[model samples]
Target: VLKDDLVYVADLFIGIQIINVSDPNNPTEFLRFGTTGANPRDLCIYESLLYYSTWYGGISVVNISNTLNPVEICHIWLSDRIEGLFVSYPYLYAANLEYSVSVFNITNPSSTYKMTEFHESVLVFDVFVVSNNIYLAGYAHGLSIMTLDKGGDLQEISQHFFPNHHHSLVIDEPYAYVGDKYSGLHVYNINCVANQRISVSLLKAGGFLALAIVLIKLSLKLLPKILEKLSPYKRGYGL
Candidate 1:
């Protein structure tokens, strides 16, 4: 839906049915690219390249530079089911149902190389990358944030736990909007990690403050008894 020059969209029913949608009201079928499997679920087009993730099959990279004769460049095998994908620069991040996210080096689109794997407790359904951080919709595990180095190694920055399953995530500037299956949509402010760290510090400070209050109360109650026993007449006070 991002491309305005997109002339056609393959229906993938009988084949890759092309519709000339130059005009929204009067769209025309131009061509078809036939294949032997189910249609693609989600796809992204970058320049002349088209990337798609399937249900039964893995990720498919196609050369759509020439839209008329689109050729299959490669099919990366991933046994773990995929739900969503986001490609940035030379890296591709896939949200897998196997409670993890798979990172691939797609610098050579014809041969996708598995770079690294990041695991979590809940099912990962969708993910998006902004700068070096990857935001994921972790079902049952809530929201997971990870930082990826230049080499594609993932370091789990932090995670926010929710009561329900999260299905989708969308980020706009400094905020992240997540869609939870049972709990509905949730919004998070991602301006900085300071907010997360602040919460942790507050909890620790609260515990320390409680301990101080308890010690002060105990001292207040015991001070009178100690003073009474410390009188010169009380022989036990000297010992």
Candidate 2:
């Protein structure tokens, strides 16, 4: 989580580290807190409170109002492991390692509660939210796109599959860049999903054009041989 010149890092074993990047060349660690128990997997900052997810289970909200002495305001325990976190205004989305993305009502910040969850069979590694859509990065299931309905229920929009396991993802408008475990990085054109019918039509047209070209070439090669056999008397019959 980035706030002004300070960057809060979720150090797995060492807890969350508050680093001061006032100097670009040489940055120093200001403070490291929340190192008591479970490993911090991910962290998100909303207002003055910082929410950090733990690997063992649940998330802890810390009061970062005083950078020198941070205080733990609230702790909410949920899934087996919280891999990633994303906060959008009053709601906080957590990617559970078990199989789902849990949503929390963080309107009160300190007194937050679970609102809803989008469940799936795949292992959710990370989550990214944009507008009303929530994108989930899975271990072997690739990516899952879902939308928040009027009743706050999660509705599946579509799913895109890839080869290796997806560790993380970042969406920039029409494109999504996914980080794979083995194959490095993968870039996907998400805009095509909206125009799927048009894309399929274009692909079908291209296939037909390619087939026509192949048939024309074969006819050009075979016509001479057919003519040679038909007009045995004259080689240049003009027929």
Q: What TM-score, computed on C-alpha atoms, does each candidate reach?
A: 0.71, 0.79
Best-performing candidate as measured by lDDT: 2
What is the model-wide C-alpha lDDT for candidate 2?
A: 0.69
TM-score of 2: 0.79
Residue 235 displacement in candidate 2 (angstroms) = 76
The all-Cα superposition gives candidate 1 an RMSD in Å to the true structure of 23.0
Runs of candidate 2 exceeding 4 Å displacement? 35-37, 195-239
Task: Report every candidate's CA lDDT.
Answer: 0.62, 0.69
Candidate that scores best on TM-score: 2
Model 1: clashing residue pairs?
none
Error of 1 at 34 (Å): 5.1
In model 2, how large is the Cα lDDT of residue 4? 66
Q: Per-residue lDDT of 112-169 in model 1, one digit per residue for the tens?
A: 8788998888888788777788888876776778889766589888887766566665
Query: Model 2, 70: alpha-carbon shift in Å?
Result: 1.1
